[model samples]
Target: MKFCYACGSPLIMKDLEHEGEVAYCEQCRQYRFPIYHSAVSMVVLNPNEDKILMIQQYGKKDNILVAGYINQKESAEEALKREMKEEIGRSILKQRFMRSEYFPKTNTLIWNFAVVIDSEDLSQVSDWEVDKAQWFSFEEAITQVKPDSLAQRFLNNFLQEYKIKSKDFFA
Candidate 1:
């Protein structure tokens, strides 16, 4: 920041007392302001219990799940639903908040959700943002996509949760 928000004085860079990071205004005793971005992701499962919906990225051509940024006046859940509709043209059945993580390296807060959808409703998938949409078994999805994608992470978590929930229900 060039000017201090609290006081309209020009900011000067200097080392902070406790933290090594540089401060914005040393004379006015102001610290540097950090900005964070919000992102939303969805883990969508099919009714057949055999496949998960994945989108082939238009830019990278790699398979990924439904995810996007939260708009100016949108909630995390709303953003996920909007992204799903815009990318795949399908409506989600049931959704539950899964987990959230902050990536300091990217200054992004990622909100993830697990959603269940009917397999028969994949007829009107969109191709504007995504090149193609396909359903893959858990094992096939994990092995086929890029290792560091959000889809892989969601699949791993979904599998773990599914196993635990199924075991508890059965036992």
Candidate 2:
């Protein structure tokens, strides 16, 4: 931060134990850390784990994973589950935490999860925020989401790790 949020003073780099150099305000006599928002992303899947769901939102051409910001007093899992029901009209029946990524452009830290929802209630997938939603095979899902994006990275990590773990679990 160029200026301190607490006291509107000029901030300089100051050595801090364990934290190294941080933005320190002489007037406030404290360190200032840049604030970033935290959000949750979900790799929606069906019960059998054979399909992955992707959504197109905000009139965007690319298919992206379902995600939303974590509200105050809500946990990351709660945020993901809420996003699941809000975006796709399905309650998450099962979920597993996957990974987190920081997007500097949006100043957002995203916690990703692999969520399983009942496919019996999947036909009517329309929310005001979501333009379109579709289910794809594991291979197709890996190809459908926007390339080189956080959505793609999260989906890839979950699917790759699931494969390894499934093999071990079965063995």
Candidate 3:
């Protein structure tokens, strides 16, 4: 940040004894404010129980789940629904909490949910934020996308939980 919000003075990067790395303002005698980003993502599953719906990013073309940033006055659930409609043009039937991960270094928090949708047809999908939508099997999805990405991590966790639940149901 160029100017301090509290006193409107210029900010400078300085090594702080207690805080380690910080932006300090000489006039305000305080550290610069930090910014945080909040995002929502959904792991949309079809009714077949064999495949998961994913989007091929327009710019990246990487296999990723439906996701987007939360707007100024929108809730996480609202953001997820809006993103789904904007990206894929489908209505989500139900959404269940999956997990949340925070990247302190990047100041980003990703809230993930597992959503149940009607089908995997992508003919009506929108090409706004996403280029196309496709269904990928659990094994294929893990092998195709970046291993360290939030989408992959969520998929892995979901698969484990799904398998356990299935086994319990059968037993």
Best by TM-score: 2
Query: Could you say which candidate leads in lDDT?
Result: 2
Q: lDDT tens digits, residues 1-171, model 1?
A: 477767778877677778765648655786867557899877677755567777777677787777888888899978877887887777777777777877666678889887777454666777677777788787887787568866677668877887678434212
Higher-scoring candidate on lDDT, 1 or 3 = 3
Q: What is the lDDT of residue 37 in candidate 3?
A: 84
lDDT of 2 by residue, 58-108 (tens): 889898998999999999988887777777888888878887989988989
Worst 10 residues of 1 by lDDT: 162-171
Report the poorest 10 consecutive residues by lDDT, candidate 3.
162-171
For all candidates, the clash counts are 0, 0, 0
Tens digits of per-residue lDDT for model 3, 1-171? 678878888899888887787989999788885767888988887766678888877678688888888898989999988888888778887777778998676677889888877667777787667786788887887787656787889888888777778534212
Worst 10 residues of 2 by lDDT: 162-171
Model 3, which residues run further than 4 Å from truth? 1-34, 104-106, 166-171
TM-score of each: 0.75, 0.90, 0.75
